[model samples]
Target: MGQLLKWLAGMLILASLACLALASWTYARSEAYLRSFERPPPFQLPIPDDEVTRARGDHLVRTRGCRGCHGDDLNGQFMWGAASAPGLPQLARGSPADFEAALRHGIGADGRALYSMPSMGFLRLRDADVAAIIAYLRSEPVIDRELPRRSLPWAIRWDLARGRDMAMPAVMNRVPPLRLEGEDSPLSRGEYFAMTTCNECHGLTLQGDSAFGDEAAPSLAVVAGYDEKAFEQLLRTGKALGDRELPRMSRVARRRFATMTDAEIDDLYAFLRQWPARTTD
Candidate 1:
């Protein structure tokens, strides 16, 4: 009986050591990734108090869905277990340039390519609109709200370790190419709205993804299943198709898009409905 007790004790020690090793590995790996992050350019928005610019900026903020993740006050919020969004961080402290790069390139302020920021969608935004968004964010009053630090989930780490996903490289890649020409056109306007706002989660292609940072999210292209009225309803009311529980999108749409003008919604719809094929310029 004494010998059996010793064996059990030995097994427990081994299990404890394994757990310690795993914890150490996870901490070390995450730190390494964080350390490797490159700092994006400093924040700078060109527009100041120009009423036209501010109005445009407001339109940009509302239409591009900035208020979705960032709170209504632009203070920032945390959301867990959603279909499309992963754990989002508060950007109040992030510089305007950091925000711009994040919006335009999907690179975080730390310079590591953001696997999460939907830069692809924002890539199509007009320079003026992008500048306007930076302007709006700059004018927002800084509200102090502490957010829990976020990390990659264990399942994602496993996937990364097993080579199931691509590691974010240490370089700034342009967001998915956009169809907007240098001039103001219908397609360009629509593209601008989609890139800056919708693309934050939707792939640059708006193809939609199930996995952002190792969690299960839904796809937006599935909107192919929704009619325009239903789509508008989903965006404005946070209701899913047939008013089912939409979880993530509902919160975002209600918070960010509920105030969007019908014209803006129509433009966004036209862009989304004819996406990929029409916008792959």
Candidate 2:
């Protein structure tokens, strides 16, 4: 029995060592990936000082899930800090060019490709809207708290190395083009809005892309079943017509979509209504 126990302990040690080696390898590979990108030429957004532009920017931030991840105050948050993932950053300290780089290109103010920010959705954002968002961020009262720096855990590094997970910049680049080809109609406005705001959770194609290990995101075509009133209620209340629990969708609705303006909701609804028909046609 003593000899058997000794053998088992040896095996356990070996297994632990193997796991550590694997984790180290993944960490090295992810570090390489993070360092591989180069920043593009410096350019700036026309950040306006007007109250209207700032207000518009604030609305965009609120509705676009920025505050949900970053924090209600736009201060850096330990979103994943308590967990193993990286913390979201405060946006107010950067220049307009820095904002543009991060928002449109997934590059951080430090010129590194952002690992956590889902910039693909914002990549389609109109220039004016981007400018407005920057203006709003700049106008926000700076929160004085310091957040812990972001750090990916070993599991994330392993997943990233194995291609089971993708970095934010890679994901952003993989998204579909900002505009549908040869499309010029009021529907285009709706499409742009959906792509910029809804695509992160749904997908660039609005088909489905579940990143959180839940069931695949349902196609937005499901919206076809909803009338305008039902849809608006869902966005505002995060509840289905029958009070069905939507989990993340519900939480996100209250945080981001609850404040959607009537026109914005209508525009989103118009595109969603037509999306299924297009798929079938």
Candidate 3:
């Protein structure tokens, strides 16, 4: 009995040591992977303090789902286990160049690649809009909120180390460049909105993703099935054609798209309507 007990204890210690070694290796590999990304050149843009620009910034923040991951008050919130979304108000007080880098390039002020920030969606944002967002964020009063320190779980770190999951910087690189340019038509306007807003959940190309299980977003081509009124209803209420409630779409629509201006919605619809012809060509 004494010898059996000794063997069991020895095995347990070996298992624990193995886990520690594996964890150390994973941490080292993930840190090296994160450090591999080269920081882009400094971004220069004038952040306007005018009320008009700030107002537009406010509108963009609210309608663009900035408040979704961040709290409704724009204070920090606990995302998944150990991952906390930092308060934007505090972050906004930083340099405009840092803000632009994070917003468009997925690089944080600390020169590290971000993890969960969806910069791919915002990659195509116009410079004026980006400046306005920073201005509005800077103008807002900082609300202090207590939150846990952000940390990635071992599983996530392992995925990053193995390249099974991509950091924000890597994902941003995969987003295609804006194709429609040099025009102020409704198509271009709509493309801008959809690319920045919808592509976060839908694939980066707005071709839809089935990998989300129950919340898989269909291609923007599905919009062709909806008329003006139905699309409006879906955007406004999150209801589908038969008044069906989508698991994630309904929640996101009400929280984000519901705030879209009528003209913006009209423009987005116009752009999506051309999806068939656009895809064919």
Candidate 4:
């Protein structure tokens, strides 16, 4: 009996030691993975101080879901456990180049790759729009708020180290460039809006993604089933044809798409209606 107990104790100690080693390795590898991305070249855009530009920026920020992750006050907000979205107003005080790097490239001012930012969605944002966003963000007064320090869980770190999960910088690289350019037609404008906004929840192509598991978004091709009125209702009130509520889409639309102007909605709907044809090509 004594010999058996000694063996069990030894096994327990070995298991603990193994866990410790695995944790150490995960931490090191995760740090290395984060550091692997090369800092992108500095991007420059002239941030306009004019009210018209700033108002446009304000509209973009309000409708583009910027306040959804960041707090409504532009102060920092706690996201998932241990992760916090930093205060944008404070962060916006940085150079336009720094803001552009973060918005379009997922690169932080510190030259490190960001993790939670959905830069993949914003990768194709027009330079003028980006400049406006930076200008608006910088124009706001910084409201000081205490936020939890951002940290990754051991499981998430392990995933990052093993390449099971991609950091935002890596994900941004996978986003395709805009296909429609130069033309100012409604279709072109709509494509820009959907790619820059919808692609965050939908797939990078706006073809939909099951990555969110139960919250998976269906392809925008589903838009074909909805007439203009139904589509408008979905965007405005988060209701489907039968007034059926979608788990994620309902909430997102009410929060983000609800703020879109009638003209913008018309453009988006027009583009989405023709999305199936574009996919075939």
Candidate 5:
């Protein structure tokens, strides 16, 4: 019996050592990918001075989660203010083209691949809208804040080493090209709104994801179940049909979608209601 117990203990130790070795390999390989991130060429957005465009751009920034990473000001912040994550660079001082590259491509000014910026979420932004975002960023107050060097935990690195969690630059490359849907129709406008904003957490197709971070977001087709009033309430308040306060979506709703104009809400609803049919077809 004593000999059997010693054998079991030995096996456990071997397993633990194997796990540690795998984790170390994962950390090193993922770090290599990040260190070798390619730099995108200079691409400029024509910064506009028009109030209407600037306002729309500002709205996009809020809804699309610029303020979530960058602070309420346009200046930099630590990634979710977590010490391990890289600090964000001050966006206000960056040229419009550099900002566009970082926003859309996940390539930084220093040419390193970003780990958490999620540029995939912003790659679908329209040309004019991109210009507007640049214009708005340029107009914001610049705050000079330096963040600590970024590092990832072993768990995240393991996921990165495996195929489960991809880097933002790779994810950005996988996104479908955005159709330049002119804003003449509600369907077009709503599709734009949903694709850009919902796609951040929802999958790129707005099909919702079972593995979105830790949450199983329902398919956006579920939006079809909501009447305009209920839908508006959900977006504006982040409460579900049962009045359950969502953890992520709720906070996002309060910060961004709550201020959506009635017309924009109407258009977004119109598009979402008709979305399931299009996805099926």
Candidate 6:
């Protein structure tokens, strides 16, 4: 019995050491990838502590899904590699233009475009709305929550190195041109907000995206199924049409949409209530 116990203890020590080694490896790799890119311009947007803008900004952040990865408190969260790629950074203080560049361009603070951010979809947001999001981030209490280090998988790295897959900058450069001609219409402004902001997960069509699967975001088209009050409830409380619970989206609504103005909400509804025209290939 004594000998058996000794053998088991030895095995346990080996396992623990193996785990430690793997963690260390992951940390080193993540740091290497982060250092590989050039940092972006300094963050310098004027973030005021105004009552109205703060409230509006907070709402904009929630509705846009900024908290999904950044943590409910706006602290950072480490996300592991999806499909063999190394994990990536999902949090940090950023300048307004830097924030704009990231959400709008999918680029990181260090100038290298982000590979993971869904900028292709968000590049549609209006300038003011984007500023509101930045304002919210700046206004919030900065929490230094420790997050896991980030890394890029060799396969993804190879793709970037070999030119098979584009870097974040290259991917973001593909954003469709913004065509907001005409006198300002409330519906048009609202549509622009939703398209650039919500489209990241809700799908380019604002219907749904199969690309994300279960991680797939819900469709705004379903909003037509709800009355104004019900729809407002969902956004404000994260509840559903039939009082059904929505775990992911609910949290988003509570944090972000809860701050939207009635006017903004009305505008948003007016735009989302209808479907976009289908396009041909």
- TM-score per candidate: 0.66, 0.82, 0.92, 0.91, 0.78, 0.65
| Clashes per candidate, residues 3 or more apart or on different chains | 13, 0, 0, 0, 0, 11
Which regions of candidate 4 fall more than 4 Å away from where they truly are?
A: 1-16, 210-214
Judge candidate 4 at residue 65 and give its lDDT.
87
Best by TM-score: 3
Q: Which model scores highest in lDDT? A: 3
Candidate 3 per-residue C-alpha lDDT over 58-162 given as tens digits, one digit per residue, 9 for 90 to 100: 988987788887889888799876768888888888877888888888887878788877788888888899999988888888988889987778888999989
* Global fold similarity of model 6 (TM-score): 0.65
Q: Give the Cα-based TM-score of candidate 3 against the true structure.
A: 0.92
Each prediction's RMSD over C-alphas, in Å, is 5.3, 3.8, 2.1, 2.2, 5.0, 7.8
- Model 1: lowest-lDDT 10 consecutive positions: 81-90
Q: Tens digit of lDDT per residue, candidate 6, span 1-281?
A: 99999999999999999988866665555445544555445445556657777676676666676666666666666655742111112222444665666766666656655677666766666565666666566656765455445546766665555456655555444454534435377767667767666666676666675233247777777776888888888877889888988867787677667877798777777766754532223
**CA-lDDT, candidates in order:** 0.62, 0.76, 0.85, 0.84, 0.74, 0.63
Residues 69-114 of candidate 4: C-alpha lDDT, one tens digit per residue: 8988877799886768888878877777788888888887777778
Which stretch of 10 consecutive residues in model 2 shows the poorest summed lDDT?
Answer: 81-90
Residue-pair clash count for candidate 3: 0
For candidate 1, lDDT tens digit of each residue in 200-272? 5665445664223343345556767889899889888989888976757788787778888888778777766
Single out the weakest 10-residue window by summed lDDT for candidate 3: 209-218
User: How many angstroms is residue 194 displaced in model 1 relative to the true structure, after the best TM-score fit?
Assistant: 3.1
Question: Candidate 5, residues 1-281: lDDT per residue as tens digits?
Answer: 99999999999999999988987788778877776667666665556788888797788888887777667675656654332232233453456666777788887666667667767778778778888877666666655566666666667777877767776787776666544365578888888787778887888777875223457666788887789998999889989767879877788888989988898899899998988787766
The parts of candidate 5 lying over 4 Å away from their true place are 1-28, 35-41, 80-89, 154-164, 178-183, 210-212
